[model samples]
Target: MVLCAGASQPPQSSQTLLAGVGDSSRASLSSGNEGGRYELTPERRALLNTIRYAEGTWKDGEDKGYQIMYGGGQFQDLSRHPERVIVKRYTSAAAGAYQFLPKTWKGVAQELRLSSFEPRHQDQAALHLAERRGALDEIDRQGLTKDAMAKLAPEWASFPTKAGHSAYGQPVKSHQELASFYSSNLRQLRNQLGA
Candidate 1:
């Protein structure tokens, strides 16, 4: 149900699923988001944007935008327009730009008190996922590793991989392409952080 910002979506109708948005997001990427957990440095935000870009978007399994989120409880992409009503019967649905399943979203969304699965809430949820995977510490050190990527693979579908996957994950690209994408983005973020 995600729509690229400014794009008009199907008008809201009788279908019901997504939780209504409120000013409930506690923390966000930008500085001084009222009640936000952490203020991301420009470098960190850039890195996250790169990761989301690589991941692409999903709306009931369709690409829509760079920043996307899903709500598993309703099997809807939470990044959808607030007024956009959808009711898909997927056993599981991934939410946010990070593709978090319902169980995962519940925890993350609760902690953040997310009013909507907007990009900011999605970023916070991804940060929490990264922290759980030990990537946050490595990212802070400006050292992203294949090992770290592997450890986090079960979470992030697009983490860099070795020995070209042939044709595995969604939005398939060449191993070389993936490597270049990851390395260039990581380098840029590190430089920005002066790390």
Candidate 2:
């Protein structure tokens, strides 16, 4: 299980998942341009935030999780993917808010034209991955659906499929739990947007 910074024993599953499932970049530090053509609508924002929540990268809605490395280590550099392999119970190159593996981050960064591991770039990379998995349309049109979650399962081991299991055989959050969080998060985002 992934530990938070300064924690001795592993936190409960509800607190963090194994940093082994899924796996970004260094372009723009500005979040505004990070979205690029993909609009960061409230629905999309909530969806990305929900993914962060599942990946154990969320903390008080801030960017603290953006620097979190595998095994709860924090990387000081944000200009590019850390590409650092942290070995605890598992070996992983995953870092950033989405916990992207080295290869996965490389691929996504190339695909999305991302330049840095900044918070917004990380967010964009995750969204691009979701879109590649054919889940973005469903997420934009209907919030989080079972099929959407299933599509994202391979991209993120923390997301549950219809069977409520991690696609990568790692630990996962329940669909119901995710849906509940999504609904609440969506509402919060919509409110912020005055939508």
Candidate 3:
């Protein structure tokens, strides 16, 4: 199985799915398959707010504040408050020890940088996703059957695709088609990342 460095294990509760919506500060959770959905409850909202505040504190370089907000064993207790899954995801993404100042912050010596660079980070994510898709396509073109492909990269079953659908489902006409898909999705995601 191909393992991503920081991919969170899929959550068990319905509330865990809400992590993908909205900005880091405010996220609305939804339920049901498609049409039927509902907003998160007040309790869930409170928990989400705590998580967001903790994230903001960490991102703003307030290490003490972040620790105070989350250090009381709260970070590891996310299962009790499933709404904090987004916070968990963010924290997990920042797990490594590399540190530098954020682009916006200057004149602060010895500041640690969080991984939120604007266009560059967005572009890198887009390129990485595109390359993965290209590799998958190459596998297919080289006569690897669906079963073989699955065996090769079992984790592909969980790889996030545009609108949560596989590229094969969308069907590619050529390499140009794949390039087009990458460009379009990259543009959309870059916009979202900026906002």
Write the residue-wise lDDT of candidate 2 on 13-127 in tens digits: 4222212111211122113344575766667776876777788776544567799887778888999988887787667778988888878888877888888888777877888
TM-score of each: 0.55, 0.82, 0.21
Ranking by TM-score: 2, 1, 3
At residue 148, candidate 1 shows an lDDT of 50
Clashing pairs in 1: 26-35, 27-36, 68-96, 68-97, 69-95, 69-96, 70-94, 70-95, 70-96
Give a tens-digit lDDT track for model 3, residues 68-110: 2211222322111112212332232221001111221121111
Q: What ordering of candidates by lDDT runs from best to worst?
A: 2, 1, 3
lDDT of 1 by residue, 1-195 (tens): 111111112222211101111122212222343345645654345345444444544222222332343322223445442322234422224444555555676677688777776666766677777777777677656544555555455565555444433123433333444334445544444453356
- Each candidate: RMSD: 10.7, 6.9, 16.8
Best by TM-score: 2
Mark the regions of model 2 whose C-alpha exceeds 4 Å error after superposition.
1-35
